[model samples]
Target: MSATVKPRYQQLKDMIIERISSGELRPADRVPSENELVELMKVSRMTANRALRELTDEGYVTRMAGRGTYVSDFRAKSHLLEVHNIADEITRRGHQHSCKVLRQSRQRSRGKIAGALHVEQGVDLFHLLLVHYENGMPIQVEDRHVVADFAPDCLSQDFRTITPSAYLTKISPLQEAEQVVRAVQPNAAVRRRLRMADDEPSLVVIRRTWSHGRPVTFARLHHPGNRYELTGHYSPPGTPKSATGNVVELEIYDHE
Candidate 1:
């Protein structure tokens, strides 16, 4: 018995990926055109096109309508344990940040919302749904629940002018927080709002914050997996580590 051979398109894709991994092709470097790949690899035009399309979809490269395809820029990364505002994060990257408040109202907490906020099933809570954009590209969908006791004016604030995180911080300082990160397939609504492809997955960060030992807010943030990553750095107690210590770790999640 013999092992199966990969398709021609896959072989071409692997070759291009190898070049990228080896730094032969750097970010924004123009990739070989379909015709060029076909001539060089002796593969059909269809095969070359398929390989390039897949690379674009996978975020390895970006294709412009008239311009040629180029290697993609580094995906944006966020600090998992940081409580910074998304707008601030975007601006720090030298990109424009904008937000659309999809929904903002007072609602009664129930089921998972109640559990996350640690409130009674019917207790009033301020709910907010917002989509954040960086350089006009939708990057995150934020669904948040705020305990009324913590931020009484949550519903009145204009989210387009001020983000929920900023408002919450102004009302009560964050004392403690916890977060869980997961990768999931986006539903139709999420995909549509994020302007993502049908096959794109999402990286979701579910977080709960406390102020003065009381639950302040619970937020679920969704990011396109191809465009965002989460990272963290920490050290154990009783160890004086250097700035370049082994405690600095990075995790990269790539979606299929």
Candidate 2:
């Protein structure tokens, strides 16, 4: 029996991915062109192109029409059970996080927003739309509305320097939190802001927080599915013992 050998294109792809994982190639760093790869690796242009094409499809790289291929800016996973600031999450991954306040103003709470915040349909509410980026790549679109009375200064604060989640936590203690996760195809506006393809689905997390039994904030966070994921670890209660008195370990993951 002989060991199987990989195709030249696959070998090339693995080499490039290794560079990326090793920190030798960073986000936005241009990868070698197909012609350059062909010259350096002594492979045909078709093989080189296939390697780059596969990388692009797998979300490891992106190619521009006029420009060249560059390493992709991918997502950093954050636990769904935790209520941490997005800036902190990005920084924990050793990447720079930036926020762009797309829109911030006082708007009348209406429809679903009103219901979620437990406010009257026509009552004034603080609305903030923000786009958060990691290493200069857009990763999340946060559309949040706060109960006006809960955070009186919500509309006046500079969200670019401080995230809405952090600001809300500072103003009031979180007594309770509720979250709903779903997979959906983003709307045109959201797709444009996230810079994702029209057919690409997104992971949407709708979170509502309350302070002292009063609704404080409701937020809809959208993350591109290919670039982001939610993960959790759980252990069963009451460890079981085997017949021989050996301890048993149990772990479960719910991908619901």
Highest lDDT against the true fold, candidate: 2
Residue lDDT tens for model 1, 114-211? 98888889999988999999999999999999998778878789988888888888877656888888899988888888898878899999889899
Residue 60 miss distance in model 1 (angstroms): 40
Whole-model lDDT values for every prediction: 0.84, 0.85
Clash pairs, model 1 backbone: none
Q: 212-247, model 2: which lDDT tens digit per residue?
A: 987889999999887776654422111123323533
The candidate 2 region of ten consecutive residues with least summed lDDT is: 234-243
Q: How does model 1 fare in lDDT?
A: 0.84
The C-alpha local distance difference test score for the whole of candidate 2 amounts to 0.85
